[model samples]
Target: MWELACLRFRHLGVSVTPSRCYRRQASSHIYIWDFLTMKRLLGLLALSSLLAGCASGLIDPNGYDETGTASYYGAKHHGKKTASGEPFNQNALTAAHRRLPFGTQVKVTNLDNNRSVVVRITDRGPHTRGRLIDLSRKAAEQLRMLRSGTARVRVQALNN
Candidate 1:
C-alpha cells in the first residue's frame, strides 16, 4: 500500500504533494503560475506599445514639403486639449499635422490666392479624411481660407 501526505503553505491552499496528491496539487500550482505569467506578459506588451507611440510621434521635418487640401478648425474645438497637451486656441497661429513634431513651424501657402501663413504645429489632425493639415481660425484667416473653409495649399517645413 502507498502512503500519501500534503503540506499546506501559508494557508494559501497551496500544498506540497506526495505521489497520491500530485495531480490535484500540481495542477493548481501550474494554473496559478500560468495566470501570473500571462498577466506579466500583458503588462509588458502594453508598456512597449506606449513607448512606441511616443517614439513614432516625431519624424524628421527636414525638406518636408507637400501640396494638399487644407482645412480649418475653430469654435467647436476651442479650449479643448490637443494631442500635445495644450489648450486649442482658434485665434492662435497654430496648426495640426499628422506627422510633424510639435513646435515645428511650417509655411502654408494658398496656391489659389498666393496668400501664406507661418504656423506652429500644436495639435494632431484634420480628423476628416484626405486632408493635409488643419489650421487654427487665425491661421486660416491669414491664409484667406476662412470663407472657403478649405484650400489647395503647399506646406513647407521650416528648419527651426
Candidate 2:
C-alpha cells in the first residue's frame, strides 16, 4: 500500500515519504488542490510555448523560403482525402505543406544528392512538427530519397 502511494506521488512529480503519508496522519496530508494548481500552471506554460512557435506558421509562395527536413507519403495514403479535400496520389507530383495554399507550386531540392523536383501543393501538412514539407512517393523517387525515407531539402515557392 505504501509503495503504491509513493509510486502515484512520483508519477505526479511529487516526492513522498512515510512521514508525509496523508492517510497515516491527518496533519501530514498535503492538500490535493496545491498539486492541481501546479499541474494547471505547467500545462499552461506548455500551451503558450506551442502557440509561440506558430508565429511563422504559414509558408508563402512569394518570398517564402526555408531549409528543413522533408519526408514523403506512399501507398498507405495513396487515395485518401487530404486536408485540401483532394484525394492524395502517391505518384503525382504533389506535396503537402503546413500552410501554403492549395494549387501553389514549390520546388523541393534534396540537399543530400542535389536532386530537385518542382511539386504542386495539393494538401496541408507534414503532420509531424519541425518538418517543413512532405512529398509524394513519386517526388521522393525523383529526389532519390526513397531509400533513406527522408532527406534535407530546401523548399522554395515558384512564381505564379
Candidate 3:
C-alpha cells in the first residue's frame, strides 16, 4: 500500500511525505479526499492564469485602426477624480480609454480636417456610450476640436 501511494503521488507530480501517508488508512474515503484536494489545487492554478491573461497593456490601441469623434471635459470637472482614479488635468495632453492602461500614448487624428495629436492615457472613459475616447481640454485645443467640442478622429495605440 505504501509503495502504491508513493507511485500515485509521483504520477500526479505531488510530493507527499512517506511518514504522513504511512499513518493514514488505505481506504476509499482517503482516495476521495486526495482526488478532491488535487482538483481544488488545479482549479486555483487555472483561475490564477486567467486573471494574469486579463491584465492590461496586452492589447494594442495604435495605427489607423480606430476612427471617431473626440471631446474634452474641463473647468467644471477639472481636478475631479477620473475613472482610473487619477485627478483630471485640464492642462495636460492626456486622454481617457475604455480599457487601455493609464500612461499609454495614443495618436489621435481628426479625420475631418486631417489634424493629429499624440496624447497619453491617464484616465478612463468618454463615459457616453459609442464614444471612443475622452481627451483633456488642452488636447482638444491641440486637435482644434474646442470650437465644435467634438471632431471626427482616428485613435491609434502607440508603442510605449
Candidate 4:
C-alpha cells in the first residue's frame, strides 16, 4: 500500500520517496488523502488553463472592421463578473467581441438607423452563432437598436 502511494505521487511528478510517505493505520481503515489532494490540484490546474487561454486568444485590433448581427445584454447580466474580471454594468458603454483585446474601443453603427456609439470591449462574446458583437444596454440604446433587440451593424475597432 505504501509503494502504491509513492507510485501515485510520483505519477504527478512529485518527489515522494518511500521514507517520506506517511502511513496512518487506524484499525482496518487506511486513509489515502490522494483524493482530496488531487481535487484541489485539479482545480488549480483548471484555473491556470483558463487564464492561459485568455492571455493567448487576444488579437490585434488594428484594421478590424466587420458587419454582422449585434445584440445587447442587460439587467440579467448586470453586476456579473465579465471575462476581463470586472463587474458588468448595463448602463456603461461597453461591449464584447470574440477576438478584440479587452479595453479596445470600437464604434458600432446600426445600419438601419445610421446611429452609432463608441463602446469599450470589456468581455468575451455574444455566444450566439452568426453574431459579430455584443453591446451593453446603454450602447444599444444609443445605437437605436433597443427596440429591435438585434441589429445589422458595422463594427470598426478604434486606435487607442
Best by lDDT: 4
Q: What is the lDDT ranking, best to worst?
A: 4, 1, 2, 3
Task: Return the candidate ranking by TM-score, descending.
Answer: 1, 4, 2, 3
Candidate 4 per-residue C-alpha lDDT over 1-160 given as tens digits, one digit per residue, 9 for 90 to 100? 6577666666767776555675423311233365656788999999999989978988889999899999999999999999899999999999999889999999999999899999999999989999999999999999988888999999999989
Better model by lDDT, 3 or 4? 4
Each prediction's TM-score versus the true structure = 0.74, 0.63, 0.60, 0.72
Regions of candidate 4 where Cα sits further than 4 Å from its true position: 1-41
Q: Candidate 2's C-alpha lDDT? A: 0.84
Tens digits of per-residue lDDT for model 2 on 1-160? 5555555566777777766664544322344546668899999999998777654665557976889999999899998998778999998999998888789888899998899999999887889988989999999999999999899999998898
State candidate 4's TM-score.
Answer: 0.72
Query: Which pairs clash in model 2?
Result: none
Local accuracy by lDDT, each model: 0.87, 0.84, 0.79, 0.87
In terms of TM-score, the best-performing candidate is: 1
Clash number for every model? Answer: 0, 0, 4, 0
TM-score of 2: 0.63
Q: How close is candidate 3 to the true structure, as a TM-score?
A: 0.60
- The superposed Cα distance between candidate 3 and the true structure at residue 45, in angstroms, equals 20
Which 10 consecutive positions of candidate 2 have the poorest summed lDDT?
24-33
